[model samples]
Target: MKIAVVGCTHAGTAAVKNMAELYPEAKITVYERNDNVSFLSCGIALYVGGVVKDANGLFYSSPSELQEMGVNMKMKHEVTNIDTEGKKIAVRNLETNEEFEDTFDKLVMTTGSWPIIPNLEGIDLNNVVLCKNYQHANHIIEKAKQAKKIAVIGAGYIGAELVEAFEVYGKEVTFIDSADRILNKYLDPEFTNLMETEFENRGVKLALNQAVTKFVGREGSVEKVVTTEGEYEADLVILC
Candidate 1:
């Protein structure tokens, strides 16, 4: 039996490993857009905040390990199109810019979520990053060290955690949200208020009830964040 997996994130890694163990005679192939797999994205803020000393610790699995387990790990390969009827797939090798096709008796799709980029002015500027993946985490940590004012757009779990991380690193952080309260959907008002108070007490600026209209940049780097309410100076902008 032959099996092909589309992604190599949490579900994909688990599926591929378990399948490789359960079906030793099966030929298992895994395609991953990234070179590394089993990255703990949730620990990005901790990494940026200096809590995680080594970035290598963030990855729980490696390609060599998978290969040793009799799994063909095709790193930096993207499954562009899938032909379910023919049991074939079109893949592109991102590193080599080569395209090819492969066949499988069984297919598994674990393509994960992507960060939604909004159409806003000055969004193409430098130091504006999306909080996802290991590459983005490394970029954020590298840039955060040189940033004085950091503005995070979105008050979700990731954004809130990033704000706390930046604060601990002694950088001024502004938390912007379109909702009336932070974590409105995740937590009740009472808990939200309590966390908000904690944030404020820790010298983190909360910009609630405001929607980001656009970003303002100068010399190819973000300088200010314009919102429905007002403008805030930010050397680095993170969209969570």
Candidate 2:
């Protein structure tokens, strides 16, 4: 049997590992757009905060390890088109820009999501970043080092964690969210209120219930965030 898996994140990694072990005689191939695989994105905040000394530890699996299990690991390869009727897929090697075709008896798609980028003025300015994946984590860490004021544009788990991490790093952090409270989807008011209080005590600014309208920048670098409620100074902005 021949199997082709698209993407190599958590789900794709698990599928390939289990299949390679269970069906030892079967031929399996995994295609990932990224060079690395199985990155623990949840640890991004810890990594940015300097808690995780080694960024390599964030990845649970690699292409080398997957290849050792008798599975073909094609990193930096994107599946451009899939023909279900013919059981064929068109692939492009990102590194060499080489195009090829492959046949598969079975296909698995674990393609993940991308961050929602809002349409706002000055958004394309330098120092504005996103929190997701391994590359994003590294970028955030590097930017955070030079940033004096950091603004996070979300109140969810990752956003809150990043806010706390920036606070610990002594960077003036402003937490902005459309909702009235942080972690409203996951925690109750009482819990969120307590967290709010703690953040306030630690000098973390909370700009809740406000929608971001524009990003004001200076000389191609982000300077301030303009929201529905108020404007806050931010040298770096993280869109969670």
Tell me each candidate's TM-score. Answer: 0.97, 0.97
Model 1 C-alpha RMSD vs. true structure (Å) is 1.0
Give lDDT for model 2.
0.95
lDDT of 1 by residue, 8-110 (tens): 9899989999999999999999999998999998898888888999988898888898999999999999999999999999999999999999999999999
Alpha-carbon local distance difference test for all models: 0.93, 0.95
lDDT of 1: 0.93
- Candidate 2 lDDT by residue in tens digits, 84-115: 99999999999999999999999999998889
In candidate 2, which residue ranges exceed 4 Å CA deviation?
none
> What value does the lDDT take at residue 75 in candidate 1?
94
